[model samples]
Target: MRIARLDTPAGPRHAVALGDRWHVIASPFAAPLVYTGDSIPADEAVLLASVDPRVVVGIGHNQPGHPLPMQAWHKSVHSVAGSGDDIYAVRDVGTVNIEGELAVVIGTSATNLTLENAFEAVLGYTVANDVTNVDQCPIDQRNFQGKSGKNYTPLGPWIETELADPENVATEVVINGAVVANSGSFNLPSSVAATLVYVTKWLTLEPGDVVLTGAPGTDLPVQPGDTVDITLAGIGTLSNTIA
Candidate 1:
């Protein structure tokens, strides 16, 4: 089911999109009457970020060609952006770039997990725009610095629970309706399960924690007022306007 958090006349509510209408679930934003049969006009609702995560962890160069040393694999990497924050082009220093990547939401707490059992720990999936400032540091340190910028990460649209095989999902990024970066689960160097296990080895993944699965080869610069669309097949699209 495609779940979304939208602004309702009553308040912000969690909803499950069923065809042309929406079914209101538990109100994470506000307490309201549970409307199991009530339907809201899709066009009138404002969609908000899907999950309010406690921590947003990012994986650097996890792709095949961008491999890092084994010693650096366990390092905690992240971008400065938090949920509901706007990403800015000015903070990127000089080389302002955006990376479209698949994000994984941990449903439950996991510690010292194995690849085979990693799937069970996942709550769902979402798309994330991993905004980076390429010119902030040297080529070797760019990934570390670029990821730490304020409001560098934007995620949401909603979490998808039906995607059992995240390793095979297709992801793409579009800039103002133009396809800029395109890749699939098949292109990833390590399996989603393996990456999850590797990540959990260092830190315990708590509920609602997010893991950005690294972007494809094509990395481009973005500016203010630009719309970035990050899409994951079977999940949903995450679009944000840079300010």
Candidate 2:
């Protein structure tokens, strides 16, 4: 089932998309209930980030071309941004930037999970815009600090449970109507299973936690008023406006 969070007249509510309309799942945006009948067309609804995870983990340099030591993964951290929020261009910082990537949601508690059992931990998949401010530090440090700007991580459109091989899907980013970053999951240096294993070794992943697989190529910079479209192969697209 495809699940999403949306701003409704009542308030923020969880919903499931079916055909051209959405079924209210949960109410009050906290714990939702599935509402059947009376569908609302997807286009008319204001889609919000699928969830506000307690922890929003990110992978650094996980792509093939930017391979780094596993220990360097400490630089990876949790980041968050609201849907349709403005991402600032840190002028004081040297070169602020943004990257688009595919994000995975944990369905169950994962502790020291093995590759064989990793899929069970996965709840669904979504699109993410991992915005960074790269100008102030060295290339290595850039991945650490610049990547975790407040309200810099935008995720959702919705979560899809039936993503054909979530670990090996295609992801792309469009800026102002132009494709900027495009790559296949095959380009990743570490498999999703490996990442889960490595991450769970230090942190216990909860049901709502999210992990953004690293971007594949050079970063893109967005100024105020620019729209970023992040798309995943099986999952839907997440569009956010930069301010």
Candidate 3:
């Protein structure tokens, strides 16, 4: 099942994709999914960001390169934008980079969630493009400077509630109509389950919080007016224009 956040007359509403249509839900933020009985034509309902994550957690360099999840940081939740939205450049730091990542949506709050049950906290999966300002600062504060810029991450289309194989999901990044990166979510230095369990041991992962499972492949360069699309095989595409 795929869930989405839609733009309604009332406001942004949570919904579920049902074939060619979508039905409003009470709150996907709650588990097992609940519908509000209101429905609409899926194509007509404008899409917003799939999930409004409370906090965006990034696990940097967690792949097979350096030992441990080398670099971790917090991206401002305001950085979250939807597909079709514009990613503006920070005036002084004009360079931009795009990365494709698998985003995990947290469903339930947990503390010290054991590995044996870590997957239980996951609500679904989605695609994320970690947009970075490459005109970075010095080594010590670079990740902070480069990643914390406004509208620096674009996530969207929809959240896939039924991900068949979370471990080996494929990801792709296309810039200005060119495929610049291709990789899978498998065999990472740190697995999703492991990351979930580890992070929750200290932080309480409440519903709607998001954990970006790191970006894969090379970070491709993009410029103002360039279109960058990040797609996770089953989740759908997140496309944004650099402005």
Candidate 4:
């Protein structure tokens, strides 16, 4: 099932994809989603970020030549934006790069988890653009200033509740009309379950929390006018403009 947060005439609403319509739901975090029977045409509803994450955890060093250990960082929750939002460039930060990554959304509180059961806490999967500005702070070091810029993380289209093999999911990044990166979750040096276990070892992930599985070898600097489209097979595309 594809779950989405949409802008309805009443306000923001949680919805489940039902054919050509968005069936209103009580909440995406609700166990056995409760449908409200109210629906809007899929083409008419505006999409919001898959979830309003309270904490956004980012993983680094999952790429080669970085390190064997997983490097994690905290980003401001306010940085989250919907698919059609603009990723504003911090003038002082100089160059801004876009890294398309597979994002894991937490459905339940998790702590001291093991790889064997790490997925139990997952709500679903969404696409995230881990926008970076290296000029604000180095990627290898603490990135409080670098990773927390307003509206830097663009996530959505919707969340896919089922994924047979997340690691095998293919990802592609396109800028303007040209394809810039062709990669997949399979390229990550570490698996999703292992990364979740690593994170839950210390930090407790709560519902609406987001974990950004690192984007490898696909980050590219963008200009103000560039439009980026990131697509993960089985999941939908997340597109945003650089401004």
Best-matching candidate per TM-score: 4
Candidate 4 lDDT over 142-192, as tens digits, reads: 877777777899989898989887778899999998999999988888888
Better of 1 and 4 by lDDT: 4
TM-score for candidate 2, please give it: 0.84
Over 69-186, each residue of candidate 2 has an lDDT whose tens digit, in order, gives 4432322234565557666655666666777777778887888988888878888877777787766447655356676666578888888878888667887878899998788666
Candidate 4 stretches with Cα past 4 Å from truth are 62-68
Q: List the residue pairs that clash in candidate 1.
A: 79-147, 81-151, 81-152, 107-123
- Which regions of candidate 3 are displaced past 4 Å? 62-69, 137-142
Residue 235 of model 1: what lDDT?
83
Report the C-alpha displacement of residue 184, candidate 3, in angstroms: 1.7
**Model 3, residue 102: what's the lDDT?**
90
lDDT of 3 by residue, 76-191 (tens): 88888888888876766656778788989988887788878887888899888887776673553747778876678787888898898888888888888988888868835677
CA-lDDT, candidates in order:
0.70, 0.72, 0.81, 0.88
TM-score of candidate 1 to 2 decimals: 0.80
Per-residue alpha-carbon lDDT of model 1 for 79-158, expressed as tens digits? 43333456766552686887777788787789888977998888778777777777764864525655665556776777
Name the runs in model 1 displaced over 4 angstroms.
Answer: 8-12, 27-39, 62-86, 139-145, 148-150
Among all windows of ten consecutive residues in candidate 4, which has the lowest summed lDDT? 60-69
Residue pairs that clash (backbone atoms under 3 angstroms), model 3: none
